[model samples]
Target: MIPQNIVKQNILDAIAVIHKEGVPKERESTKYHLWYNGGLYPPKYVISVANRFANGHALSRDRFNGGAETNNFLKRLGFEVIEETLATKNEMQMSEEQTFRVGEYYSRNDIYQKLNVPKAKQKGHWNTGYTQYEKDSFIFANVGTAGRTGHDHPNRFDGNDLIWYGRNKSTLTQSSIQSLINPEGRTYIFAREDSNDPKFLFLGNGRAKDYFDESPVKIIWSFDNETENHPEILAEEVNELEIYTEGSVKKVSVNVYERNPIARKKCIEHYGLGCQVCGFNFVNIYGIIGENFIHVHHLKPLHEISEKYEIDPVEDLRPICPNCHAMLHKRKPAYSIEELKRIIKDKVTDTPH
Candidate 1:
């Protein structure tokens, strides 16, 4: 029996503790989760962590039984345990046997076996980009970041947008493309921090926002559901200071750190897409193609900082156009928002001293 001393706050603290240490992928639940604060968490792990608050040490997994005992206990405390994720827009819902959590990570094979996807309808080979699990009316696009899989049909994320390209040497009429366009079905795209990572984040249920080109069709997917961050996936920036050996290459190595999209969105939401310094708005100039196309500038340079610190998007970052963003970085330590504003004002008025 759980100690009566253990309360709801203890469970919340446990989640924070686990998040800081990195949630163990192996311990994540495939079916059951305690849905709290709009995030899905493994119930057993929650119990284990919550015990640390009630007692000095974590309760051994052997001491407790799962399923009814755990579920009932959480229920008694006003916490709800559901199978995978909650549904929306309609009465649609995936069962305990097939549903997956949005932020949860799973390998390609694991997802296939868990959902019992049919062998006949599997999209194609692993390198074929998308796997169509028609049995569940879903298509999973296993995408690659920029150069990791080469320039050919690379699926990259632009802030909240996912820029994905269909398989090369294919047409828009293909089954996979049809599945994407079909309003009757759904699509889920997954990607990892690096090539070595085995599991991909179930990004979210994506709706087709825009599409263009052919042969290898380019599509933009927008997610209405919640999104999470992979810290290693940094934004696109030129490295001007790194040493280079252009010709003869030995063993190749690379390291990447991704800007938090959630943070970027928060900054944009607070400041809008208008450039803070020069007042240029991409959407106003470029139509639908340039919507949500403002560069974000950090008040403190990311490269100069060596420690981990919490970022307050509204306070620490601002939206700027590419031209203004580049000008702000023309000097070391970058220019202040006020300084750049003053410069722009002076230039516009032709009052430079």
Candidate 2:
């Protein structure tokens, strides 16, 4: 177990390093600096932070030697660090000219490779492993003028579903669309309203017609064009229909509560099945493992509220191990997430002077 003082000091040191070495690049845009594009903090600062934390550790393998040390140190500090192994410098760069590369998109193979775990080789080709919620979360995080445009493209295996919204759609073409897909796989293309040359195009990852004569191809075109309202009929004239020999179809269902489950799981996973509000790990508090469950409580009751309003789970949920959960409401109303986090931070600071 890491000492509380050590954790606090390390975090402070990391922040200090970030402030000093992580000086914003003069050429880089202010927005990029603010967002910590490519990865959080500058590469130099990240390395500094990692070196400070990993000063004495057997696992200080050189595998993370080239600025990857930050990820390792963050992992040690009980934060989930998702490094984009597949993204190249150019792809991940936050410059205005930066564009999405085929490799930047995460796939099942990418996930397996990153996890360093082997599984049965996937037969089908797919672009991204992100669920609907994950995709929407990404969109929400980068919305409006502040958000960069033209990053929203469908993955391979999606059959002509143009659900994405973006700016400057006129530049898109059949050839331009093909460049988005690599030789290894295909990608889904969502037509935008901004494009004057409106035509339904499904770029890659479709079965051969011999495999299946009739496959359900769902195509959504912009409502801006009343004539293009019938996408299925319009697609037939262009022979945009394609078949998949052995590929999986990606489906996205919109739900009211998107990030709640993810936040809950993350809290449990990060805190090690323990309550952050009160230091109650399952084994430490309860002898029976079965009884040692952590419950996620929403700061604002979600179900009671109507679906018309959008709620952010990050601002709402608190993970309390079963013991803390019971004790929290024993007398007064349950504490808000902010209150709980403050209490936990205080407890950690106050321990042993």
Candidate 3:
């Protein structure tokens, strides 16, 4: 069976890729800003490079311009390319499985090249959001800083975001694993091995620990263990001993660390404690009382429980002001702040008055 820790770590890794390389942002209404320093290039060039380095097949002009050229460049650097289009009547559909496969392919190959870097004297810090135990226990086995090295550095752009490169795997105690699985009474997305389907499994829950003997998850870092800096993966070896029937592995609630107090404070500092949803500037409204105000909210919900029962803070909390918080839970079943904003916007746009 695919280990639970590996599944969660992979999901986090995938999310990071999506956030960094999914697409470009626009300024005002006119200028388009690509994530990399390079501005816009032709579609063909981009596609070509992507195809070469990371086996990316579908290159959409509307979504990704210059995809062809990108694929070609990657090929020159030594990477596989896979291109296949679905036969949808109107919109072209690409499977998440395929997208994730491309990401995994690039990540694995990148690790191969990163293994060449000289080991660092001190290990990098681990940010588990609780005690420093997890960070201290980290041992970089192989791999180097994700981007700054080798033939493994594939130019795989999800949209305009840079997909970092490197790999490292490590083990975490069951206690630590519990904290990660269901931090602060919420669940997060994770990956696991499907007993029925050996391909892969995507799950969101706390039951992931049952797959392991001692440690809950085996993390594979993309950077060298000696250096200790960089993201790591939680993985397990797939062998005959782990095989099981379908439904034997089930999804349960678990906590995840996406945002914490420090992160929330940073966002408030950047946005000046204003409600991004309603444009309510706290300072202007409440004066001095609102000085260090504003609450942070998580875009995703975390699971409240796990198999082992662990309590974590970082994975389940977000900051937000009371007004916004109330608004979030105002309706029956509640609505996300973003969802509320969209609903309000639509209502106004359609109003005759």
Q: Best candidate, lDDT-wise? A: 1
How many backbone collisions does model 2 have?
8
1 or 2: which has the higher TM-score? 1
TM-scores for candidates 1 onward, in order: 0.42, 0.28, 0.24
User: What tens-digit string does per-residue lDDT give for candidate 2 at 234-346?
Assistant: 22223222222235343332222321323333344444545667656543332222122456555554445774543443455555664555555553455654576687788
Report the lDDT tens digits of candidate 1 across residue range 89-200: 1112221222564545668776767767676644355445565554323433443433235543556666556777776666677766767766554576665545556676
All candidates in order of TM-score, best leading: 1, 2, 3
By TM-score, who's the top model here?
1
Candidate 3 structure quality by residue, lDDT tens digits, 140-188: 1111112221222221212111122212222354454445433454222
Q: Which ten residues in a row have the lowest lDDT in candidate 1?
A: 88-97
Better of 1 and 2 by lDDT: 1
Give the range of the ten consecutive residues with the poorest summed lDDT in model 3: 226-235
Better of 2 and 3 by TM-score: 2
